[model samples]
Target: MTETLRKKYRWDRIGLVLGGLAIFSFGLAAWVAPEEEQVGSVLEHPNNAELPESIPALRVQEIQTEKAKEPELDEVVLPCSCNRNVLKLAKNPYSDHRRAARNLPNSFFVKDSNELNAGKRNGKLVEVKDGRGFHISALSHSHAVLLPEVKALLEDLGNDFADLLVGTPSEGTRIRVTSLTRTVKQQNRLGRRNYNAIDEASTHSYGASFDIAFTDRPDNAADCSAPTRAIQQVLSQYQKSKRILVIPELSCMHVTLRP
Candidate 1:
């Protein structure tokens, strides 16, 4: 009887152990099955359903563009022989001669009447005398051959009037000439012959070459008016004819056969 009771007790313990194991196994399956389903859903759908529909997806793109700008060029202007101020003086006939004269230095000398007549008659020597007096000391003679042509042109301009005056600097004006003459000889000796120096062979070496200056009249108001007008007219005519070249800065006129 003791042995049989012992065997029955062993069977009862085994049965109880099996029942506890079954309950534990059921709890594990319930927890693990839900988690496995959630993992599968995450793998299938990367975007979460909880995210707002209004939120847009991010985008990237490249754009080409150009900046606005002003035009580089508008119009081209033609070069002219006469400038604006020269045109203005040409139009204003009664401009002030004293003002113009005052602008000139004291060194300027006029060609004398006698020399002027001789140049016109002989058509050879290019000499200009002092405007203050008809003295030979104030005269300058050039060796350029074109002196005759320059003189002829000046004569044509009718600059030989009693009132009109021709003047030159005591030294000389800066200009270019393309001739061989005695004037170039003296200038070369004095080291005054620069690249721009008028060649003795140049037309400017002729006494016919001239620069204008105001008459030394006490009454600046009266004498300057008519003479300035007349001079301007003559200059304008010469410019139009291309007989004389005027450099405004030097206030000197260069006359020649060449343009």
Candidate 2:
């Protein structure tokens, strides 16, 4: 009986040890298995999943696009008769003639009254009627028959010249008659004959010509104070641009069309 009891006790001890080992193994498996599963699940879903298309950097690219679309400014086209370096005066009708006269060469001066009258008959002189005169002619020359565009331009030039005389700015710069085809007498260097000569087949013949004489003083009437330097600057520019012809002389300029 003693031997049996001892054997039973030994067997009990062995069973306890086996049970403890089984419990430990189960606990380890529960903790480690869950950690492995969590790692696998994280690996399946990447951080970038469900994202939309690639976004562009608008700050840099948009500015570049806008800059490319900007319009260029118009270039200054100088008249051809003057040197290319000269700057063009603004197309202000009131000041254009005065500015033009100031820019014209000294060679262009009005001859004596008789010479001018002779030139008027020979198709060499262009007589531009003032607004008042032009209005009268307009009644006779139907608007449909006349070249409106040319006429408008001449009228604009005339108005501009008148404005210059009155010390106003040219607001409406246009041409009325492009080429009137009149005649005038030109005096020679010696000032002897007043023959019907084409002083200049100028736009002036079309009533587009204007003369700029300087004022002597605030109230003085006879003397002139035309600025030669300023006029030359203008003529130089026109010559370069091929807009008009400039003849430089003592006190006046003979300005006319380029051709």
Candidate 3:
């Protein structure tokens, strides 16, 4: 009876150990296995994966948040009031302006940016900035520069313009110089769009001309009449004196420094 009881106890112990081993192996398999939905979700966001893109992105924004640049005051063309009814000044043709422009001291056709830079370095051209009487507009197709004589003429004109309106409501009015020296390339480009570029070549390429588009008032203290009359008087005096040639264009007054 004792021998049979020992045999049964040994068999029972072996069976219990085998059952525990099977349960542990099944639990480990369940823990290691992943669902199909989990793998698809991970693939959707490749950027969040272990590696970056092999090919770089083109036209990708350098800055995530950047403001658009705003245009300058001179970049925008203002409406002009100078015409037959207003100002009523003498009108010079592009022919006359070009003729005078071509005859200036050491005058030569400025064909490109290289010539322009050489002119500036050798004193053929002088830099022009916003001064007392006139403020240079933000030039897109032109440069803020002129011949020494032309710059002097511009300064004188500004002084006279301010003097004329002394004690008047338009005392602080300023002439808006819209255009100045331009390269031949710039002229050719403008000619396609600007009817005023009627001449085969523009005087602006010689740094001998400028355009006045508006008489900017300091305040609304007075109407444009006073300022308009002042422009008429000054421009007329200069034109009659043969000091400067003028072209009364639809949008602006083109003034050339006479040779």
Q: Best by TM-score, which number?
A: 3
TM-score of 2: 0.25
Reference-based lDDT, each prediction? 0.38, 0.37, 0.80
RMSD, candidate 3, Å: 8.8
Q: Report the lDDT tens digits of candidate 2 across residue range 78-162.
A: 1112121332333323233334433333212333455444544553344445451122123211111112233343354344333
- Residue-wise C-alpha lDDT for candidate 3, range 1-259, written one tens digit per residue: 8889889987887788788778877876665455445666777767566335433332233322222223343344333365545667777877888899999875667779999999999999889987765788888999998998999889988889899988998887888898898897788788877776657678998888998888877766777888788888888999999999988877788899898
Evaluate model 1: give its TM-score: 0.33
lDDT winner between 1 and 3, please give it: 3
What pairs collide in candidate 3? 74-138
Off by over 4 Å in 1: 1-137, 140-146, 159-182, 189-203, 206-208, 213-223, 249-251, 257-259
lDDT of 1: 0.38
Residue runs of model 2 more than 4 Å from their true location after superposition: 1-226
The TM-scores, one per candidate, come to 0.33, 0.25, 0.67
lDDT ranking, best first: 3, 1, 2
The best candidate by lDDT is 3
